[model samples]
Target: ALTWWNSHVRIVGNDAADVMTWIELKKKMADTYCPRNEMKKIESEFWNLEVQEESDRVERYIGGLPDSIHGSVTASKPKTMQEATEMTTGLMDKKICTYAERQAANKRKFEDTSRNNQGQQQPPKRQDVAREYAAGSGSRPLCPKCNFNHDGPCTPRCYKCNKIGHLSHDCRSPTNANVAKNLRGNGAGQKVTCYKCGAQGHFK
Candidate 1:
Protein backbone atom coordinates (compact mmCIF):
# COMPACT_ATOMS: atom_id res chain seq x y z
CA ALA A 1 0.00 0.00 0.00
CA LEU A 2 2.82 2.43 0.83
CA THR A 3 4.60 1.62 -2.44
CA TRP A 4 1.43 2.27 -4.47
CA TRP A 5 0.84 5.54 -2.64
CA ASN A 6 4.47 6.67 -3.24
CA SER A 7 4.24 5.74 -6.91
CA HIS A 8 1.00 7.72 -7.32
CA VAL A 9 2.29 10.84 -5.46
CA ARG A 10 2.43 13.69 -7.99
CA ILE A 11 4.76 16.76 -7.68
CA VAL A 12 4.36 19.88 -9.82
CA GLY A 13 7.55 21.89 -10.11
CA ASN A 14 10.03 22.73 -12.87
CA ASP A 15 13.01 22.77 -10.44
CA ALA A 16 14.65 19.36 -10.19
CA ALA A 17 16.05 20.21 -6.75
CA ASP A 18 12.60 21.00 -5.33
CA VAL A 19 11.14 17.79 -6.81
CA MET A 20 14.00 15.73 -5.30
CA THR A 21 13.54 17.39 -1.89
CA TRP A 22 9.82 16.57 -1.83
CA ILE A 23 10.44 12.99 -2.87
CA GLU A 24 13.05 12.50 -0.13
CA LEU A 25 10.75 14.08 2.52
CA LYS A 26 7.86 11.79 1.45
CA LYS A 27 10.10 8.71 1.52
CA LYS A 28 11.41 9.62 5.02
CA MET A 29 7.81 10.11 6.33
CA ALA A 30 6.67 6.76 4.91
CA ASP A 31 9.75 4.96 6.37
CA THR A 32 9.36 6.57 9.83
CA TYR A 33 5.69 5.55 10.21
CA CYS A 34 6.02 1.96 11.58
CA PRO A 35 3.48 2.16 14.51
CA ARG A 36 -0.03 3.58 14.76
CA ASN A 37 1.14 6.60 16.79
CA GLU A 38 3.87 7.36 14.22
CA MET A 39 1.25 7.08 11.49
CA LYS A 40 -0.87 9.63 13.29
CA LYS A 41 2.16 11.93 13.50
CA ILE A 42 2.67 11.50 9.77
CA GLU A 43 -0.97 12.42 9.13
CA SER A 44 -0.54 15.51 11.31
CA GLU A 45 2.58 16.47 9.38
CA PHE A 46 0.69 16.03 6.08
CA TRP A 47 -2.05 18.29 7.36
CA ASN A 48 0.61 20.87 8.31
CA LEU A 49 2.13 20.61 4.83
CA GLU A 50 -1.28 21.26 3.26
CA VAL A 51 -1.83 24.28 5.52
CA GLN A 52 1.59 25.68 4.55
CA GLU A 53 0.77 25.31 0.89
CA GLU A 54 -2.49 27.24 1.34
CA SER A 55 -0.66 29.95 3.31
CA ASP A 56 1.92 30.27 0.53
CA ARG A 57 -0.88 30.59 -2.07
CA VAL A 58 -2.53 33.39 0.00
CA GLU A 59 0.81 35.18 0.43
CA ARG A 60 1.45 35.00 -3.33
CA TYR A 61 -1.97 36.58 -3.99
CA ILE A 62 -1.33 39.36 -1.46
CA GLY A 63 2.08 40.02 -3.16
CA GLY A 64 5.17 41.60 -1.65
CA LEU A 65 4.44 44.93 0.04
CA PRO A 66 5.93 47.28 2.62
CA ASP A 67 5.91 46.42 6.32
CA SER A 68 3.11 48.92 7.02
CA ILE A 69 0.75 47.31 4.49
CA HIS A 70 1.77 43.83 5.60
CA GLY A 71 0.96 44.71 9.24
CA SER A 72 -2.53 45.83 8.22
CA VAL A 73 -3.29 42.32 6.95
CA THR A 74 -2.70 40.74 10.38
CA ALA A 75 -5.58 39.09 12.26
CA SER A 76 -5.28 41.51 15.17
CA LYS A 77 -5.59 44.54 12.89
CA PRO A 78 -8.30 44.07 10.25
CA LYS A 79 -11.83 42.88 11.09
CA THR A 80 -11.80 40.32 8.26
CA MET A 81 -9.53 38.98 5.53
CA GLN A 82 -11.35 41.03 2.91
CA GLU A 83 -11.00 44.13 5.04
CA ALA A 84 -7.33 43.41 5.55
CA THR A 85 -6.91 43.07 1.78
CA GLU A 86 -8.78 46.31 1.16
CA MET A 87 -6.74 48.19 3.76
CA THR A 88 -3.47 46.80 2.44
CA THR A 89 -4.48 47.90 -1.09
CA GLY A 90 -5.68 51.37 0.16
CA LEU A 91 -9.19 50.75 -1.15
CA MET A 92 -11.35 51.35 1.97
CA ASP A 93 -9.35 53.64 4.30
CA LYS A 94 -11.14 56.79 3.10
CA LYS A 95 -14.58 55.34 3.67
CA ILE A 96 -13.52 54.02 7.09
CA CYS A 97 -12.17 57.47 8.06
CA THR A 98 -15.38 59.21 6.92
CA TYR A 99 -17.54 56.78 8.87
CA ALA A 100 -15.41 57.33 11.97
CA GLU A 101 -15.77 61.12 11.64
CA ARG A 102 -19.54 60.87 11.34
CA GLN A 103 -19.65 58.63 14.40
CA ALA A 104 -17.56 61.15 16.37
CA ALA A 105 -19.86 63.99 15.33
CA ASN A 106 -22.91 62.04 16.43
CA LYS A 107 -21.28 61.31 19.78
CA ARG A 108 -20.50 64.99 20.32
CA LYS A 109 -24.07 65.95 19.43
CA PHE A 110 -25.45 63.41 21.90
CA GLU A 111 -23.20 64.75 24.66
CA ASP A 112 -24.24 68.34 23.96
CA THR A 113 -27.92 67.40 24.01
CA SER A 114 -27.50 65.61 27.31
CA ARG A 115 -25.79 68.66 28.82
CA ASN A 116 -28.55 71.02 27.65
CA ASN A 117 -31.23 68.73 29.01
CA GLN A 118 -29.51 68.65 32.38
CA GLY A 119 -29.30 72.43 32.45
CA GLN A 120 -32.98 72.83 31.61
CA GLN A 121 -34.02 70.25 34.20
CA GLN A 122 -32.28 72.12 37.03
CA PRO A 123 -34.03 75.09 38.71
CA PRO A 124 -32.66 78.56 37.95
CA LYS A 125 -30.98 80.78 40.57
CA ARG A 126 -33.36 83.65 39.84
CA GLN A 127 -36.36 81.47 40.52
CA ASP A 128 -34.90 80.39 43.82
CA VAL A 129 -34.26 84.03 44.73
CA ALA A 130 -37.84 84.98 43.86
CA ARG A 131 -39.19 82.15 45.96
CA GLU A 132 -37.10 83.22 48.92
CA TYR A 133 -38.28 86.83 48.56
CA ALA A 134 -41.94 85.78 48.44
CA ALA A 135 -41.54 83.54 51.50
CA GLY A 136 -39.78 86.36 53.46
CA SER A 137 -42.41 88.94 52.51
CA GLY A 138 -45.26 86.64 53.55
CA SER A 139 -43.68 86.07 57.00
CA ARG A 140 -43.13 89.82 57.82
CA PRO A 141 -45.25 91.68 60.37
CA LEU A 142 -48.27 93.71 59.22
CA CYS A 143 -50.10 96.72 60.71
CA PRO A 144 -53.16 95.80 62.76
CA LYS A 145 -55.43 98.57 61.45
CA CYS A 146 -54.68 98.41 57.66
CA ASN A 147 -53.31 94.82 57.42
CA PHE A 148 -50.21 96.08 55.62
CA ASN A 149 -46.50 96.30 56.30
CA HIS A 150 -44.82 99.20 58.13
CA ASP A 151 -43.87 100.83 54.83
CA GLY A 152 -47.53 101.47 54.03
CA PRO A 153 -49.45 104.66 55.00
CA CYS A 154 -50.71 104.95 58.59
CA THR A 155 -54.54 105.29 58.91
CA PRO A 156 -55.08 104.27 62.54
CA ARG A 157 -57.82 105.90 64.63
CA CYS A 158 -57.73 107.02 68.30
CA TYR A 159 -60.46 105.30 70.37
CA LYS A 160 -60.39 107.86 73.21
CA CYS A 161 -60.76 111.02 71.03
CA ASN A 162 -62.68 109.28 68.23
CA LYS A 163 -60.32 110.84 65.68
CA ILE A 164 -58.58 109.34 62.63
CA GLY A 165 -54.86 109.14 61.85
CA HIS A 166 -53.64 108.76 65.48
CA LEU A 167 -53.64 105.89 68.01
CA SER A 168 -55.36 106.07 71.47
CA HIS A 169 -51.97 106.11 73.24
CA ASP A 170 -51.00 109.41 71.49
CA CYS A 171 -54.39 111.09 71.75
CA ARG A 172 -54.46 114.87 73.04
CA SER A 173 -58.16 115.31 73.79
CA PRO A 174 -58.95 117.46 76.90
CA THR A 175 -61.30 116.49 79.73
CA ASN A 176 -64.70 118.33 79.76
CA ALA A 177 -65.13 120.55 82.86
CA ASN A 178 -68.96 120.91 82.50
CA VAL A 179 -69.63 117.19 82.60
CA ALA A 180 -70.73 117.19 86.33
CA LYS A 181 -72.77 120.35 85.96
CA ASN A 182 -74.59 118.99 82.88
CA LEU A 183 -75.34 115.73 84.72
CA ARG A 184 -76.80 117.63 87.76
CA GLY A 185 -79.10 119.77 85.63
CA ASN A 186 -80.37 116.79 83.68
CA GLY A 187 -81.21 114.99 86.98
CA ALA A 188 -83.04 117.91 88.70
CA GLY A 189 -86.24 115.97 89.39
CA GLN A 190 -84.28 113.06 90.95
CA LYS A 191 -82.59 113.21 94.38
CA VAL A 192 -78.81 112.71 93.85
CA THR A 193 -76.49 111.88 96.75
CA CYS A 194 -73.18 113.72 97.31
CA TYR A 195 -70.80 110.99 98.43
CA LYS A 196 -68.19 113.51 99.69
CA CYS A 197 -70.40 114.92 102.55
CA GLY A 198 -73.14 112.31 102.77
CA ALA A 199 -75.77 114.86 101.61
CA GLN A 200 -78.72 114.29 99.23
CA GLY A 201 -78.19 117.17 96.83
CA HIS A 202 -75.75 116.08 94.00
CA PHE A 203 -73.59 113.10 92.95
CA LYS A 204 -69.90 113.07 93.84
Candidate 2:
Protein backbone atom coordinates (compact mmCIF):
# COMPACT_ATOMS: atom_id res chain seq x y z
CA ALA A 1 0.00 0.00 0.00
CA LEU A 2 2.83 2.36 0.82
CA THR A 3 4.38 1.33 -2.48
CA TRP A 4 1.10 2.44 -4.00
CA TRP A 5 1.65 5.74 -2.25
CA ASN A 6 5.37 6.23 -2.94
CA SER A 7 5.19 4.82 -6.45
CA HIS A 8 1.76 6.21 -7.18
CA VAL A 9 -0.05 8.11 -4.40
CA ARG A 10 2.20 10.72 -2.80
CA ILE A 11 3.41 12.94 -5.61
CA VAL A 12 1.31 16.03 -6.38
CA GLY A 13 -2.28 16.16 -5.10
CA ASN A 14 -3.21 16.29 -1.44
CA ASP A 15 -6.97 15.95 -1.87
CA ALA A 16 -8.22 12.42 -2.60
CA ALA A 17 -10.71 13.93 -5.04
CA ASP A 18 -7.94 15.42 -7.16
CA VAL A 19 -6.58 11.98 -7.97
CA MET A 20 -9.89 11.01 -9.67
CA THR A 21 -10.48 7.43 -10.97
CA TRP A 22 -8.05 4.78 -9.76
CA ILE A 23 -6.08 4.89 -12.99
CA GLU A 24 -6.13 8.69 -13.10
CA LEU A 25 -5.39 8.77 -9.38
CA LYS A 26 -2.47 6.47 -9.95
CA LYS A 27 -1.13 8.80 -12.61
CA LYS A 28 -1.62 11.88 -10.43
CA MET A 29 0.02 10.21 -7.44
CA ALA A 30 2.95 9.14 -9.56
CA ASP A 31 4.23 12.73 -10.01
CA THR A 32 1.80 13.73 -12.77
CA TYR A 33 -0.41 16.54 -11.55
CA CYS A 34 -4.12 16.06 -12.23
CA PRO A 35 -6.75 18.82 -11.83
CA ARG A 36 -9.14 18.80 -8.88
CA ASN A 37 -12.31 19.16 -10.99
CA GLU A 38 -11.47 16.23 -13.27
CA MET A 39 -10.62 14.01 -10.28
CA LYS A 40 -13.85 15.03 -8.53
CA LYS A 41 -15.91 13.96 -11.54
CA ILE A 42 -14.28 10.56 -11.74
CA GLU A 43 -14.56 10.07 -7.98
CA SER A 44 -18.19 11.05 -7.94
CA GLU A 45 -18.97 8.71 -10.82
CA PHE A 46 -17.07 5.85 -9.21
CA TRP A 47 -18.84 6.19 -5.87
CA ASN A 48 -22.21 6.53 -7.55
CA LEU A 49 -21.68 3.31 -9.52
CA GLU A 50 -20.12 1.44 -6.60
CA VAL A 51 -22.73 2.43 -4.00
CA GLN A 52 -25.73 2.26 -6.31
CA GLU A 53 -26.46 5.90 -5.51
CA GLU A 54 -27.86 8.41 -7.96
CA SER A 55 -25.20 10.37 -9.83
CA ASP A 56 -26.72 13.67 -8.61
CA ARG A 57 -26.41 12.57 -4.99
CA VAL A 58 -22.79 11.48 -5.56
CA GLU A 59 -21.95 14.83 -7.09
CA ARG A 60 -23.62 16.69 -4.27
CA TYR A 61 -21.80 14.62 -1.67
CA ILE A 62 -18.45 15.21 -3.38
CA GLY A 63 -19.15 18.95 -3.53
CA GLY A 64 -19.86 18.94 0.20
CA LEU A 65 -16.69 17.08 1.34
CA PRO A 66 -13.02 18.12 1.68
CA ASP A 67 -10.82 16.09 -0.72
CA SER A 68 -8.53 14.11 1.61
CA ILE A 69 -9.91 10.60 1.10
CA HIS A 70 -8.85 9.51 -2.40
CA GLY A 71 -10.68 6.20 -2.69
CA SER A 72 -14.37 5.83 -1.91
CA VAL A 73 -15.55 4.17 1.30
CA THR A 74 -17.70 1.66 -0.47
CA ALA A 75 -16.86 -1.73 1.04
CA SER A 76 -14.26 -3.68 -0.91
CA LYS A 77 -16.24 -6.29 -2.76
CA PRO A 78 -14.94 -9.20 -4.78
CA LYS A 79 -14.97 -8.45 -8.49
CA THR A 80 -17.28 -11.46 -8.93
CA MET A 81 -18.87 -12.04 -5.53
CA GLN A 82 -20.47 -15.34 -6.52
CA GLU A 83 -17.31 -16.81 -8.03
CA ALA A 84 -15.30 -15.73 -5.00
CA THR A 85 -17.23 -18.07 -2.72
CA GLU A 86 -15.07 -21.06 -1.83
CA MET A 87 -17.43 -24.01 -1.59
CA THR A 88 -16.14 -26.56 0.89
CA THR A 89 -17.81 -28.89 3.30
CA GLY A 90 -18.25 -27.04 6.59
CA LEU A 91 -16.27 -29.97 8.00
CA MET A 92 -13.10 -28.93 6.12
CA ASP A 93 -12.32 -25.56 7.62
CA LYS A 94 -8.85 -24.41 8.74
CA LYS A 95 -9.14 -26.17 12.10
CA ILE A 96 -10.19 -29.38 10.39
CA CYS A 97 -7.34 -29.33 7.89
CA THR A 98 -4.76 -28.68 10.59
CA TYR A 99 -6.07 -31.54 12.69
CA ALA A 100 -6.28 -33.82 9.66
CA GLU A 101 -2.66 -33.13 8.72
CA ARG A 102 -1.40 -33.76 12.24
CA GLN A 103 -3.43 -36.94 12.62
CA ALA A 104 -2.27 -38.27 9.27
CA ALA A 105 1.37 -37.62 10.17
CA ASN A 106 0.96 -39.33 13.53
CA LYS A 107 -0.77 -42.25 11.89
CA ARG A 108 2.11 -42.71 9.49
CA LYS A 109 4.46 -42.78 12.45
CA PHE A 110 2.43 -45.41 14.30
CA GLU A 111 2.11 -47.58 11.19
CA ASP A 112 5.84 -47.44 10.70
CA THR A 113 6.43 -48.30 14.35
CA SER A 114 4.16 -51.29 14.03
CA ARG A 115 6.02 -52.49 10.91
CA ASN A 116 9.41 -51.97 12.53
CA ASN A 117 8.24 -53.82 15.65
CA GLN A 118 7.81 -56.84 13.36
CA GLY A 119 11.19 -56.64 11.59
CA GLN A 120 14.64 -55.05 11.49
CA GLN A 121 14.48 -51.49 10.27
CA GLN A 122 16.89 -49.23 8.49
CA PRO A 123 15.95 -46.40 10.85
CA PRO A 124 15.12 -47.27 14.46
CA LYS A 125 13.01 -44.26 15.44
CA ARG A 126 11.52 -41.02 14.25
CA GLN A 127 14.60 -38.94 15.06
CA ASP A 128 16.88 -41.50 13.47
CA VAL A 129 14.69 -41.66 10.41
CA ALA A 130 14.59 -37.87 10.21
CA ARG A 131 18.39 -37.60 10.41
CA GLU A 132 18.81 -40.50 7.98
CA TYR A 133 16.79 -38.82 5.27
CA ALA A 134 17.57 -35.23 6.20
CA ALA A 135 19.19 -32.90 3.63
CA GLY A 136 22.20 -32.62 5.96
CA SER A 137 24.04 -35.95 6.10
CA GLY A 138 27.19 -37.67 4.84
CA SER A 139 26.10 -36.46 1.42
CA ARG A 140 26.07 -32.90 2.76
CA PRO A 141 28.69 -30.80 4.56
CA LEU A 142 28.25 -27.44 6.13
CA CYS A 143 30.84 -25.78 3.92
CA PRO A 144 33.62 -26.72 1.56
CA LYS A 145 35.87 -23.90 2.75
CA CYS A 146 35.54 -24.88 6.40
CA ASN A 147 33.84 -27.43 8.72
CA PHE A 148 30.50 -25.66 8.32
CA ASN A 149 27.63 -28.11 7.66
CA HIS A 150 26.28 -28.69 4.17
CA ASP A 151 23.69 -30.90 2.48
CA GLY A 152 26.27 -33.71 2.66
CA PRO A 153 29.97 -34.41 2.45
CA CYS A 154 31.51 -34.33 -0.99
CA THR A 155 30.70 -37.43 -3.05
CA PRO A 156 33.75 -37.14 -5.26
CA ARG A 157 35.30 -40.58 -4.94
CA CYS A 158 39.02 -40.92 -4.23
CA TYR A 159 40.82 -40.54 -7.53
CA LYS A 160 43.36 -43.10 -6.32
CA CYS A 161 41.17 -45.54 -4.35
CA ASN A 162 37.88 -45.25 -6.24
CA LYS A 163 36.10 -45.31 -2.85
CA ILE A 164 33.73 -42.87 -1.09
CA GLY A 165 35.63 -42.14 2.17
CA HIS A 166 38.91 -40.26 1.85
CA LEU A 167 39.96 -38.17 -1.13
CA SER A 168 43.03 -38.91 -3.28
CA HIS A 169 45.12 -36.93 -0.79
CA ASP A 170 45.06 -39.79 1.78
CA CYS A 171 44.83 -42.70 -0.67
CA ARG A 172 47.61 -45.32 -0.86
CA SER A 173 48.47 -44.62 -4.51
CA PRO A 174 51.13 -41.96 -5.10
CA THR A 175 49.78 -38.75 -6.52
CA ASN A 176 50.17 -38.12 -10.26
CA ALA A 177 52.45 -35.15 -11.05
CA ASN A 178 50.03 -33.98 -13.75
CA VAL A 179 47.02 -34.38 -11.39
CA ALA A 180 48.91 -32.54 -8.62
CA LYS A 181 49.72 -29.64 -10.95
CA ASN A 182 46.13 -29.57 -12.13
CA LEU A 183 44.43 -29.63 -8.68
CA ARG A 184 43.03 -26.54 -7.05
CA GLY A 185 41.77 -26.50 -3.48
CA ASN A 186 39.00 -24.73 -1.58
CA GLY A 187 38.05 -22.15 -4.20
CA ALA A 188 38.92 -20.41 -7.39
CA GLY A 189 42.42 -18.87 -7.67
CA GLN A 190 43.60 -20.52 -4.43
CA LYS A 191 47.11 -21.99 -4.29
CA VAL A 192 48.32 -24.84 -2.10
CA THR A 193 50.82 -27.67 -1.86
CA CYS A 194 49.26 -31.01 -2.81
CA TYR A 195 49.22 -33.08 0.37
CA LYS A 196 49.65 -36.28 -1.68
CA CYS A 197 52.77 -35.30 -3.62
CA GLY A 198 53.99 -32.24 -1.73
CA ALA A 199 54.07 -30.35 -5.03
CA GLN A 200 52.37 -26.91 -5.02
CA GLY A 201 49.20 -26.46 -7.03
CA HIS A 202 46.10 -26.47 -4.88
CA PHE A 203 45.06 -28.87 -2.15
CA LYS A 204 42.13 -31.12 -1.20
lDDT of each: 0.59, 0.53
lDDT of 1 by residue, 112-174 (tens): 999999878866697687556655676566666544445557788765445688776665544
Task: Report the number of the highest-TM-score candidate.
Answer: 1
Per-model C-alpha RMSD: 26.2, 23.9
Each model's number of backbone clashes? Answer: 0, 15
Cα lDDT tens digits, model 2, 125-151, are 876665555545566545553233455
For candidate 2, the per-residue lDDT at 187 reads: 62
lDDT value, candidate 1, whole model: 0.59
Worst 10 residues of 2 by lDDT: 69-78
Q: List the candidates' TM-scores in order.
A: 0.25, 0.20
